[model samples]
Target: MFALYITHPQVRIDPDVAVPKWGLSDIGSARARLAAESAWAGQLRRIISSNEVKAIETANILASASGVPVEIVEGMHENDRSATGFLPPPEFEMAADWFFAHPHDSFRGWERAIDAQTRIVSKVEAILAEHDPQAPIAFIGHGGVGTLLKCHIAGRPIARQGDQPAGGGNLFCFDLANRAISCDWTPMESWKGESRKG
Candidate 1:
């Protein structure tokens, strides 16, 4: 069987509030709706989401459609950029580049990419350890850590190439039994939920 790893869609950018508290924009909600109605969405037996509002909202949308409950999973948040606060897109992109380029080093007090990767890997592995792999599942989270998890499962080095395309709301899939990534990031609305023989 395969499990989906989904990144929350576009958020209502609020320069005034903490980033994690940001919720989905109208467009994001619509996209989430489309994804929820996707044929593959019905295959999901459970949804696990990061505690961030955006992720939870996305998971809730999908969960409602799948007739499953959304389970909040702590420690699955985006890389800690709260230390530096919000940066304009250009500056933020540059910092993100540095963050990936130097996975072992902190960029301006932000969490080291390697550390974040380790944390995500540990938490996901723990989840897998406890879950029954007979059914498919989805993990709703942020792009940074989702990419980190992708890279780890693919046995690739930490790099931005694994990151989702601009605008978020994307997903990847991996085999639940063997922990091998089977797909790269695809927009949630467009993905067909490719089948896995497992």
Candidate 2:
């Protein structure tokens, strides 16, 4: 079986709002549309996404075209950073640095990398076990969480990080039977000038 792990480009996070759960921005929505178009136009058998508006919106678009209904998976939601929501950019950066420095532990209210890895990998494993080995599955998630999940699937150290550029998208294909990342973070060039990883 093949699985396509994906992520939403960007969400409309209200900088002024203390808790930002804003929907996708104009550009973000565009990127998501393109991502969906690319995946649905290809070989994805099913679509899964986090319940967040941004991811759901993207998944719905693909589902509409693919003639399949979306399955909202709670475990696929973005890594929670509730403990440090709405910090100024600089403070957020500093906190993120600290979080990365200690991946096994949570910084503030954010998810511990180990916990996130466990949940994501477990959920994905269960899904893979249920699907036909010849079919492909797609997931729409957040950038950071998506990259971390990819690392887990690749058998890389959980503490290591990957690029997660803003307004970018990644496509990874996992071959279930062989336990291989058949493909990793293939850049979608339809939307030019944007880095695929942050």
Candidate 3:
């Protein structure tokens, strides 16, 4: 009854390409492979992912290693920033801070942080409600919404403090039965802990 919410790893950042279409970099793939080799990977019975390419790629690597079929869940995407299009990293950081700091307000017409959190929580709950609670599941997604989900599960207020560290390829675990977080965000490949193995 354990569930891991995992964010995809580093991606090929190209200014010309659509952000969602960008796949993992070589280092990202290698990191995912290493994480898949962990003993924890063997315990996963279900794998779900966002429709984004990077998340799907990460899910595929994990599914291949675990022999679990990857299922795409439609509503599990990154927060909708399409309204403002892509911003450079520095600008992105500023926008993200605004997103979390002002949960009720939309920054530059993007999805309101509160709204995104609600959607993610609703979708995740619906998915869990339909699945076998006795089975352990993994959900692969992007950092933005992943942090939002983490905050909900952790009973934390919307804040950047709840977000993952700078890089990607991170995860946190919670109990499927009660939705209580057992572990906070940590590196997917290197963290060794009770929750990590579940």
- Identify the candidate with maximal lDDT: 1
Give the poorly placed runs of model 2, Cα more than 4 Å off.
16-20, 39-42, 188-198
lDDT agreement with native, every candidate: 0.92, 0.68, 0.88
Please, what's the RMSD in Å of model 1? 0.9
Tell me model 3's lDDT, rounded to 2 decimals.
Answer: 0.88
TM-score of each: 0.97, 0.83, 0.95
- Superposed model 3: Cα runs more than 4 Å off: 193-198
Q: Candidate 1's error at 1, in angstroms? A: 0.5
Question: Best candidate per TM-score, number?
Answer: 1
Predictions ranked by TM-score, top down? 1, 3, 2
Better of 1 and 3 by lDDT: 1
TM-score of 2: 0.83
1-198: candidate 2 lDDT, tens digit per residue: 566677766566686654325577787777666755654335557888887777787777666657777899877776787776677767876776776667887887798877777777788778777877766678777766677788877777654356455454556666657767766576542422212221
